[model samples]
Structures are given as C-alpha cells and as structure tokens.
Target: MKFLIAIALLSLSSCAVHHHHHYPDAPQTSAEPEYGNTDELYADEQDYVDDDEEPDSPAVAYPEDMPEEEAEPTTHQPEYPQYEPEETRTANQPKVPSVLQNCDVENFETGWIVAKCGSAELFVQTGPAARGSYYELSNFAATYATMVTNQETAYWGKRSAISVNGARGESTEYQFRAMKPGLFGGGTVDKDGEIIAHGIFTTAKTQHGKAGMLCLTYGSADKASCQRYFNALGKDLKELGRKNGPVMVGGVALRSEGKCHFLRPRELACSNGSLTWQGGSRQALENLVETTIAKWTDDHGIAGFYNPHLVTKCTIAGQTSTCHEVRFQGVMSTPAEIRHATLLEHQSLAVMCTYSTQESAPPPCTKFFGKS
Candidate 1:
C-alpha cells in the first residue's frame, strides 16, 4: 500500500510539470529582422500594422514651424497686332490744266494775236513802241476787240485783256519783228495816214522796272479761223510770263499829277517836281551793283534795274514845285542782295507814301498802289 501510494504521487507530480511546460500562457517577443532582408516577415507584419493595431514602425514627428512646399505655376504668352506702310506722292509729277484744249484762240491779226481761254488773257506783239502810242492804238481796237470777239465766240470763256505793245527799234524788235510766227497788229493811221505795224508782244513788268516781251507767232491770218491758234498762243504766253525772262531797261521815271500817276520805264525829261534819291553812299551803291551783276552771271539769271525814278513821285508844296523823283542804280549783286533790294524797295515805299491824315505820321509807300 505504501509503495503504490508513493508511485501515484510521483506520477502526478511529473504530469503537472509536463502540463505547465507545454501549455505556458506568458507574452512572446519576435526576433529582430536583418537590415533589409525580411520580405516575408515585413509582408506578414503588414496585416498586423492596421485595424487599430499599434504601429511597430519608429515614430516620425513634423515640426510645427516648418513651411510647406509650393506648386509651380503655368506660363502664358500674349499676341500683338500687325502694322502696314502708308502711301506717298513722288516729286517729278506734272500738273495738268483744268480747261479743255479745244477753245483756246479768240482772234488773230498782223503782228498781234489775242487769245482767251479759262482765266487767261494773251496779247502778243512784235516790237518796242512808246507806251502811250502803243496803248492808244492796240489796247482799244486790236487787243480789246480781239479779246471781245474771242469771248463772244467761245461757249464758256471769261476774258481779261493783257495789253502787249511794241516799238520798231530795241531788243523787242529783234525778238518780235525778227520772228514772224506770232500775233501781229498794225497801229491806227498816224496824222500822216500811213498804216505802220505797231509794237508787237506782251509785256511782263518786273519789280526792277524792266519789261519782258512775250511773243506768240502761231496763229491764223483771218481772225475768224484763229480760235485754236489763239488758245495755243495764250497758253504759251502764260507760261512765258511765269518764267519772267531777263529784260534790259534803258531808263525809268515816276510822275504824278494830283491822282493821275504814271510809271515811265525809259528816262524822260520831267516837266514838274523836285527829286530826292536814297539807297546808300555812292561807293556802297556801286559795290552792291557790282555784286548783283556777279551773282546774276553765276546763276545765269536777269538782274532788276531799280529806277527809283519809275517808282516814286512827290509834288512840292509850292504851286510851281517840281515833282520829286528818286533813283538807285546797280550793275551786279548776289541773288540774296537782289532779293533784299526788292524787299527794301517795297518797305521803303511804305514809309515814303502817305495814306492817312495823322500829323506827325508818314503814310506807307505801298498805299500808293491802292492796297495791292
């Protein structure tokens, strides 16, 4: 009985020790993974990493003061409008006349041709003549009548008479009489009743008191058939006047009686008035004249003859007082001096002439021309 009981106690004790060792219920720890070599372990651990399970990874905390990175912005481009060039006119273009070419001539005569078309008046003559004698014969009967006849014939012609007078001798004679292809006119019978070809061309009076002769030779013999011929002559004469060729003035003088005033191109003996001349000292005047001549030669242009005698005339206060005249003469000068002389003459006239009644004031010289 004692041996059996002892055996049972030993068996019981062994069984209890075996059961405790095999069924231990305490927590277990996993082995540390090698540096980068636990693919299976890491993948399996992924399942235990979530679903409210405490993470096994090391804690990573961000700083409260650190700034966040900013995203890059997209770029954009802009477009602009295109520009174009403008048109311009060239300098060499010619200007055409407005009037028709058909109705040009009005009348034709010996040594004279009268033409009217548009706003132009053309009087063509042949030689130099006394101003009074030329005007008396030509202005009334030949030029005036021809102009009137031409206007009457044309459908829409407005006429102005440009008187052309010529004398038998002088540069005009060589220019007009020598050339027969222009307008022609005969002076009225003189006291002797002889018909003579009067002076022949148109005249362009220069600022220097010289006259330019304009000649027109292309025209018809019978005044009635010379319409086209007259027109051509008129056009040519207008162009010539604009060109203003050089003129040789033999002399010039101015005279006035009351309101009647006359400008004389050739020096003539004056029956009345005293004379006063102003320009510069004799030596200075001579120098200016030489200078003007030199410039004219260089430019191949004409120089003006300033005949104070032809521009101004003043009556003396006394009843028998002679008319006062002034004169300035120069042979050569620069173009600038020529221009200056022209301007000076124009201004001088203004100061010398009287138009107003102010006691201490002198009237402007330009006033004598009745306001241009």
Candidate 2:
C-alpha cells in the first residue's frame, strides 16, 4: 500500500509541474470582441454620379462648425426680384395747368419751358443772343396765336411798348409790337376791341431766377382785360397756376441741362419691400431672360432697331445686370431725345444697341452704363 501511494503522489506532482510550465504568461490577447465599438467602419452602399456629371453651379462650402446634417445643400438657388404693374397717381398739383405742373423751374436750364393752364398751353424757348435788336421771334407770332385766341398774326395791327409784372411783382419792360390788328376789338373775340399784342424780352426770371428768354402774348375781351397782362404779367401768369419755384418733377434732360434722370432698374421688392423670400429662386427667370436675349440679338438687335420692349426695366442701386442706351446717329436732327426703350433686369443690364450713326454697329453701351 505504501509503495503504490508513493508512486501515485510522484505522478500527480510531475503532471501538475508540467502543466504549470506549459502555460507561460505571454501577453494576453482577446480574440473575443471588446465591450466598445470596433475601430473599423463598414460604409453603407451609396449611389453617386461620376465627377464629370456635376451640375453647372459650383458647390458652396459650409462653415466648419456646421454639422453635416444641418448644412444647406449646394443645389439651392438664390432668390431674385420680380416685376409688377406700376401704380400711377395724379399730380399733387391737380388744379395747376397740366403744362406748368409738368414743367419744373429746373427745365429753364435746358433752354425750353412747356406748361399748360386752363384751356391754354405755353411753350417758351430762348433764342440765340441778339447782336443789338431783339430777334424776329421766329415762332413767336404762331405761338401767340395758339396760346391766346386762334387769330392769325395778320389780325394784330396795333403796336405799343409795355411793362409787364412777373410772378413776384418785379417789373420787366418789354417791347410790345403789333403782329395783327383788330384781334380784340368791338367786344369781339377776334376784333380790334379784342386786341392782341406780342413782344420779345430778355429776363433772368427763369426757374430760380436763371437767365432766359421771355415771349409775351396778351389778349382781352376788351381793353381793360388786355391792360391787366401788361400791369402784372407775372402775377397774372402765376394766378393762372404756373410754377413758382424749382420742383422735383422729372422731364427731358436737354444738352444745356447737362444731367440726366435715367429710369432706374427693376427691383425684386416684395409687398413688404424685403429683397429676399424663402424658397425664392432665380434659375428659371435667368433661363428665360437668356433665351429672350439670344433670340433678340439673332433677329433685330444687330440692326440696332430692337423690337418693342417686352418688359420695362429701371435702374437702381446695388443691382447687377446689363442695362444700356445708345445715341443713334440721327440723320439731320438728333431728335433732342433719349429713347427709354430697353428691357432691363438691372441698370447694369442697360445696353446701347448701336453707335450714334446708323452706319456704325452698336457701341459699348454696355460698358458706359456698367460704370454707372
């Protein structure tokens, strides 16, 4: 029994020592997954076009602080303004003659004045400086007949020199002469008792007292009515509703005027006057405009005679679009006029289609207005 027990104990000790030696403490590595997520990421399958298939608009970059989910996409289009019918209002000075209401004192700087009163319209122009004697008043006689009574110059034979008063009671003497006789006579609308007289004078009595020419025309149902014109010419004209001072009214900018009030570019103002709108987009508008311009340039623009404007455009600040005008070479007369007939998305879009001469191609109207 002792021998058998000793042999068993030796065997047990050998087996235990061998097992301990075989299992040395190498670095313990876990083939089993850790408690945390794996370092390697497997991407979900996505459908993407090749780099060459990108759209025209450049990609917009979002701020680094913005989250990928919260960032706006590059495919978004910016909003732009649109056009609506312009509302018209009657002139504030409705009782004033249409002519006087339309003619501002500033207009005198341009060498002409056009005004209207009750049943009468006055068109005044300053002629060239006279050597010594006043001018023949080239259009005077005809103009007088049109303004006062419809009698011709042949009807006024009575002549006289007279002093006329202005709007401010300042006395300006004029050389009144007879153009035709019997215009106001015998209580007749066109007889001698109904006399008509015409004169030419130089006065600094223009808008803001600027120097300009004055043509006088006076008529009366009788001598008493005629005398009032000579006594208080300015007062009578003012009481007739002529302008008293320079006004903000707009009109032709003649060469002498030396400045222009070009119409402004159309704007994209909303009813609340805000320039932007949510979800507003301009891609479609831009496409339509591009197509129209292309078609126009192909058909009529090269000739400088554009088709009637399909749209009305104005010039305004901060706008970026092509807007222009041209001085077409008028044959004998340069029409003393600037044509306001261009379709504009912005003042920058105003382009003069042609050079001054009909023979010349369109000059760089685009460049001139661009600087504006």
- Give the candidate number with the greatest lDDT: 2
* lDDT to native, each model: 0.21, 0.24
Best by TM-score: 2
The parts of candidate 1 lying over 4 Å away from their true place are 1-121, 124-176, 179-216, 219-222, 225-340, 344-372
Model 2 segments beyond 4 Å from truth? Answer: 1-90, 94-120, 124-162, 166-207, 210-340, 343-372
| C-alpha lDDT of candidate 2 relative to the true structure | 0.24
lDDT tens digits, residues 1-372, model 1?
Answer: 110001111122112100001100101101111110000001111110011111111111112232233211211112111111111111221232233243343211112223443333344431111122222222212222222331111000111234323222221210011111212221111122211222233233322122223222223222222233333433444322112111111111132222111111111111111111223333443444334334333332335543223222332211121122222223423111111111123112111121221121111122122221
Model 2: ten consecutive residues of lowest lDDT: 17-26
Over all chains combined, what TM-score does candidate 1 have? 0.19
**Measured by TM-score, how close is model 2 to the native structure?**
0.27
Give per-model TM-scores. 0.19, 0.27
Please estimate how well model 1 matches the true structure, expressed as its whole-model Cα lDDT: 0.21
